[model samples]
Target: MAEGISSDYAVIELWKAVKSIKKDAQDVSVIEGNIPKVAEMVMEYILKNINYFVPINNNLVRPKTYPIDNDPMSVNWLFVLHTLNFSLWYPKGTKQWKVDGKKGYFGLCNAIRRAIEDGKPIWNPEYYTKMTKSELECILQSDDGEPEIPLIDERLRILHEVGEVLLQKYKGTFMECLKLSEYDADKLMKLLSMNSSHIGTK
Candidate 1:
């Protein structure tokens, strides 16, 4: 996979960004630096508190019966899907505000799972890269009388970008980026953030 874009380049660029900030702006400095001991201490603290790092929970948006089920690619695809999951609120005074009693993020998750059941290629990046608005609308369809989710075009764009990046840089699996992180929580966060946007600096 050497022919693919080097993730090392991203790490190096992040370091450069970290160094360019003013001394007074020490947010990234607290997270990264040449101080090995401080870095080790941070990692140890994360390890000690790993149980609290869980993002998924009973109250979160997820498939009821475990849709992915040992499929790493599907799990990664879920992460990619969530990267752009937002703005699901309906207009004020709308009578229909839910998709089969699931509203907002949960409603979105329900619709996506239903699409997968209906044979949409939810786990295939190639399919999403060229997904059409009509197709997306179909997949995102709400229950009858319910308001549709907002930002259809932005969702499609995010899906396209995620598909392109995964195929080009991570060999069609977000786990590749995870592997590159080598079990370090900070590096994993940085790698994932590189795909989205930078924080603290901008």
Candidate 2:
């Protein structure tokens, strides 16, 4: 789907890469003796939590603190959320960034929700395409006395980059891309991989 790389080729390459790494790695080794035990444990866990594995069941349940729902806006919100999801981990001994008393990924979600509640059209490509560093700082600000979110400038740049892509090519909404993909997960993935720089193929 990405130019010369077909889906099948990508899968084959991924498998070969993993195998090569496992063969050459000095620091990590597979425990063949533990395979059966680990398999049993995994199977037991899957059996015990099979209900949670139902796609519809989990899709119906989401934290209220997330600014998402069963709509196109939710798709765009998820796009924005994942675009800024990285580098949340702070250095050892540093104060964790927080929002609405939550830390890490939850903190990011709460910040986006708070921004929407405060009338910031954060999910809209038009707004984020031109968003300033100062505005993003305010949106992702942490609790009092805590360090700021890590990689704040990188996040801002990524938002602007992806926002411009959406605005220029996808009609300012990811829904257009989804429609073009006809709701096919593989097609959508390929579409994103081909069009967006930050949305990695893996």
Tell me, by lDDT, which candidate is best.
2
lDDT of 2 at 115: 93
TM-score of each: 0.62, 0.69
Tens digit of lDDT per residue, candidate 2, span 1-202? 2222323445578789999989999999999999999999999998898877765444654555655356658889988988898767654345678888877777888999989989999999899978999999999988773688888888988888888788888899988988999999999999988876554332
lDDT of each: 0.67, 0.80
Question: On residues 47-103, what C-alpha lDDT tens digit does candidate 1 reach at each position?
Answer: 887776444453353456345557655666576457646766644345433555766
Q: What stretches of model 1 exceed 4 Å from their correct place?
A: 1-69, 95-97, 197-202
- Cα miss at 15, model 2 (Å)? 19
**TM-score of candidate 1 versus the correct structure, residues matched by position:** 0.62
Best by TM-score: 2
